[model samples]
Target chain A: EDQVTQSPEALRLQEGESSSLNCSYTVSGLRGLFWYRQDPGKGPEFLFTLYSAGEEKEKERLKATLTKKESFLHITAPKPEDSATYLCAVQDSSSSNTGKLIFGQGTTLQVKP
Target chain B: DAGITQSPRHKVTETGTPVTLRCHQTENHRYMYWYRQDPGHGLRLIHYSYGVKDTDKGEVSDGYSVSRSKTEDFLLTLESATSSQTSVYFCATQPGVAKNIQYFGAGTRLSVL
Candidate 1:
């Protein structure tokens, strides 16, 4: 079974603070690791996709890095607008045809200005 | 935010009633998905469609059913609503299996009272 686990369920950070969210996973074979941000009352927004270990992707103040068994979403100098629930999901190679995703519990980030 | 829209942005209904949520996409994507979000659970796949008339269940598909009669629309129905079914539902789309980037709709908030 494919599973994703995210740690530090909730975090409160001051504006411009830098931190990283952790996502650990166990899968038969990894096809992709995804990062998403979701705000209250809204669906998730895609951020980045890392296809292999040692791969990294970034968007503005957010950066995502993937390893064989874990992934990290690093936020650099975060702002109030960056406050949202960060989600981590993985798609195993076995699901290449179906494109199914197994998601984590997510980390709620609050950036205080 | 990707030309996808979910109807009945918010709904409230009594338990035991039947309910259906509609997801419409203008991108003409070949794959569509339905997922639910709740506290302590990031997002769990309910069902997904690979193409018109081709649908399959996901990990948490027990109480949900889905249909895709057209490429641009996917509908998820709850046969019998229960209090535990109250959640924020999201619809997502992907261009194809090789490209796993998924774009999500605004989401629908359902409350089964």
Candidate 2:
């Protein structure tokens, strides 16, 4: 079975704090990895996609990096508004054509002001 | 934010009753998905559609059913609602093949009493 696990179910940080959330997976033939931010009571918003090992993509305070077995979402100098549940999903080779995604539990981040 | 919308943002019902959640997208994507979110368990896929009338089950597909009869709408129905089915249901859609970015609807908070 393809599985995705995220660490530190919840994290609290002072504003401007820098930290990284982790998503580890066990799947065969990874086609792509994705990062999304979801606010409480709302839908998730797409953030980044990393396709191969050693690949990274950045959007403001967020940077996503991927490897063979894990992916990291690095948030630098985060703000209070950045406090949201970050989700990681994988698109395996077989689901590539259909756009099916397997998602991790998500890291709930709280940036205190 | 990518033109995806879910109806009945909040619903509370009793067990054994049938419930239907709707997801509509204006992005004209070819793929649509239904998922449920729960603490510790993360987001679990319930069902997905590659195209109209082309739907498949996901990891947690039991007790739930889905239908997609048009290009822009997908519906997820719980055949017999249970307390265990109480969850925040989300609908997502993305362009197939060359595109991997998934856009999600605001979600429907369903409480099976």
Candidate 3:
């Protein structure tokens, strides 16, 4: 069974604090790993897609790195505006044709100012 | 914001009633997906459509059915609503398998009482 697990269900960080969220997966074959940001009462917003091990992608204060067994989303000097639920999902090779993604429970981060 | 829209942003219905949620995309993407988000469970795929009239079940497809009669529309129906089905449902679209990047709608919050 392909599965995804995200650690630290909830985190409270002060403004300007940096942190990293973890996403680990066990899959038959990894086709892709995705990161998303979801605000309250809203749908998730796409963040990054890592296709292979050792691949890294960055956008502003956010950086995502992927490895064979896990992926990490690092937030640098996060502000209150950056507070949101971070979601991680994995696309198994078996579900490639349909583009199905198995998602994790997500990590809710709160940046207190 | 890939031009995806989900109807009935908020709905409250009784158990055993049939409910349908509509997802419309302006880009005429070939792939559309339905997922349910819940606390502690994350987001789980309910069903997906590869193309017009082509659909497949996802990890959590029980009691859910989907249809895509045209290129830009996807519908998800719950034959009989249950209390356990209360969730925030999301709709996503992907251009193709190769792209693998999915854009999401604002989501529909459903409550079954």
Candidate 4:
């Protein structure tokens, strides 16, 4: 079965601390991987999309890198504004072509100022 | 931000009552999706519409129904709300130009008593 798992269910870091979140997947054929940032009581906001292995995307203090079996979201010197639940989702090649995605449980990060 | 709106930003209902949530997108995207977010379950797809009158089930579609009568509106209905159905629901739209990238709305929080 196709599935996504994210590590470090919750993390608390002092401001300016760096950390990495992991998203491991098991799918028949990987089509794409997506990263989203969600604030409490709000919907998810799209961050980046990785289509193939070795692909990387960056925005501000966040960088996402993808590999054959997993993806990593690296936060460099994160601030309190960067403290949000990070979500990882995967699209499989065998999906119905309507762009279905399987999501992970997400990693909750807290950056204390 | 993408032009997506979810109605009834918050709702409270009793079990066995019927409820409907609305998702409207002004972008005219061909694909619309419904997902529910919970603490440990992350985001799970409930249903999706590819076009007007074309809808399909997702991994967690049971007890739910969806309709897309026009190009801009998609509705998700719970024939009889249950306590288990209480969750934060999100709506997403995928622009045809980049089918893999999805934009989301603010989400609706539902509570079932």
Among the numbered candidates, top DockQ falls to 3
For A1-113, candidate 2 gives per-residue lDDT tens digits of 78899988999999998999999998888999999999988899999998999999999999999989999999999999999999999988998878888899898999999
Tens digits of lDDT, candidate 3, B1-113 = 79999998999999999999999999878999999998989999999999999999988999999999999999999999999999999999999978889999999999999
Error of 3 at B93 (Å): 0.6
- The per-model DockQ list reads 0.84, 0.88, 0.92, 0.73
Compared with the true structure, what per-residue lDDT tens digits does model 4 show for residues B53-101? 9999998999999999999999999999999999999999997635668
Q: Which 10 consecutive residues of model 2 chain B have the lowest summed lDDT? A: B93-102
Best by TM-score: 3
Candidate 4 overall Cα lDDT vs. reference?
A: 0.94
Docking quality band of candidate 3, CAPRI definitions: high
Candidate 2 per-residue lDDT, tens place, B31-105, comes to: 999999988788888999999999999889999999999999999999899999999999998887898798989
How accurate locally, in lDDT, is each candidate? 0.93, 0.92, 0.95, 0.94
Per-candidate TM equals: 0.97, 0.96, 0.98, 0.97
Q: Which of the two candidates, 1 or 3, achieves a greater TM-score against the reference? A: 3
Better lDDT candidate (1, 2): 1
- For model 3, name the residue pairs that clash: none
Question: Which of 3 and 4 is the better model by DockQ?
Answer: 3
The structural similarity of chain B in model 2 to the true chain B, as TM-score, is 0.98
